[model samples]
Target: MTNDEKVRSIRSKIKCMKSTNEQGFDVIIWMRKRFLQSEAFVKNLKRIIDAGFIEKWTNYLNLQDISQRLLAREGAIKDPEIKFEEIKTIFVLLLVGHALAASVLILELWYSKRSRKY
Candidate 1:
């Protein structure tokens, strides 16, 4: 299949998966099992990245992360052990730090641009 067709297929699969009743860990696991970990999907992902669609993939990951966290907490109530608390906590902290670092870089870029306008 062409790269565009591959991308469309991957996106459609993701949309269908997100529409399912599964949430958080289950959704992630299912996606990994069904699509994300597949060779075809990886190839398509690399093609998309090479085609300069990084922002689209980044947005998708951000959305998936939000969905996972929102449902993960609810899932934890039913089975606390399923949450993997320590790992989740570390992952969250790392994400926060990454966001902070990105924000700082963006601010620096903005300041530099503004200074150049003077």
Candidate 2:
């Protein structure tokens, strides 16, 4: 299947899985695997970044604060160096990244359709 099709399929799966309680944390892992790592998603994300949406979104999200919190959490972890809070932060970052990618794709699709309608 094409990359766009793959992205659509993954998005649909995410919507479906999100509605059920069976997967739990596995749903996040699955989303990271299927959406964040998809080739089309990466390409669209790069395009969005090139268009400066990353800067705009990051500013809106106050990512610097999130980064500082993540750093503090990292410093607090000893020996094993992996804490649940750290994992949660990482997961939240992944979700934010995925949201950005999906938003870009949606905008692109919407623009394409709007242009076609004109």
Candidate 3:
């Protein structure tokens, strides 16, 4: 693509990436969990994500100011390799998240117990 075209593309993408108060990854997860537990759609997820997602995701991550430097709680570590990883890897995490929290908290409980063991 031409330089001008590329710039326009990037600018358009950036417009939709406000990470704070806009990016709703955690909210999405909460909705999904709620749905499976009660076999009901607890909330309208589309409205929760409509503002940012149809816009774009990675661009949203960039525009977020989530205070990455803040210390972790209990037992957590900020690994550089994990941060350097690309956004494409999120699909893998999605699969993992779905499997862990699909229709009930059983999978979640199992994973939590196992994760702590290691």
Candidate 4:
């Protein structure tokens, strides 16, 4: 469907949902959870997001913000190898930290044993 058509569909969904009072929040929550593709739909989402703020639906607004951030970051890590390397680097750092801690404990135990013998 065209972007304009998607915008109309989204608006209609919101309108029907609005008739049920609190269901407006449900519509916003649904939109926040879905992967909206159309630019127009995204724009509509941004515009309607203010309704959540005005309604004081803090949790829903936060979810919308998180979803928006996820969408913004969706294309940032397009390379699987790059992400794998990042994970590998983090894992190596954690392993090094654990090895250092273990070595310190072993040295402390050996030192205490030597002192006791003296």
- Candidate 3 C-alpha lDDT tens digits along 21-112: 55533221222322443222212333434466555565545544443423343334556574535766797888888976774688777878
What's the TM-score of every candidate structure? 0.29, 0.31, 0.17, 0.36
Question: lDDT by residue for model 4 over 32-95, one digit each (tens)?
Answer: 3345555755576757754564344545665666676787787553434566766898999999
Best by TM-score: 4
The global Cα lDDT (0 to 1) of model 4 is: 0.61
Candidate 2 on 1-118: residue-level lDDT in tens? 7656655654443321222233322222233534545785546645765687644654645655566668788896345667788799889999999999999999999989989953
Q: Rank by TM-score, descending?
A: 4, 2, 1, 3
TM-score of 4: 0.36
Give candidate 1's whole-model lDDT. Answer: 0.61
Residue 101 displacement (Å), model 3? 59
Question: What lDDT does each candidate get?
Answer: 0.61, 0.59, 0.48, 0.61
The reply for model 1, stretches above 4 Å from the true place, is 1-83
Residue-level lDDT tens digits of model 1 in 1-118: 7545655555544422233334322112124334534666657666765685654555677687778788888885354455577589889999999999999999999999989953
Please identify which of the two predictions, 2 or 3, would achieve the higher TM-score against the true structure.
2
Clashing pairs in 3: 17-60
Q: After best superposition, candidate 3 residue 51: deviation in angstroms? A: 22
Query: What local lDDT does model 4 show for residue 48?
Result: 72
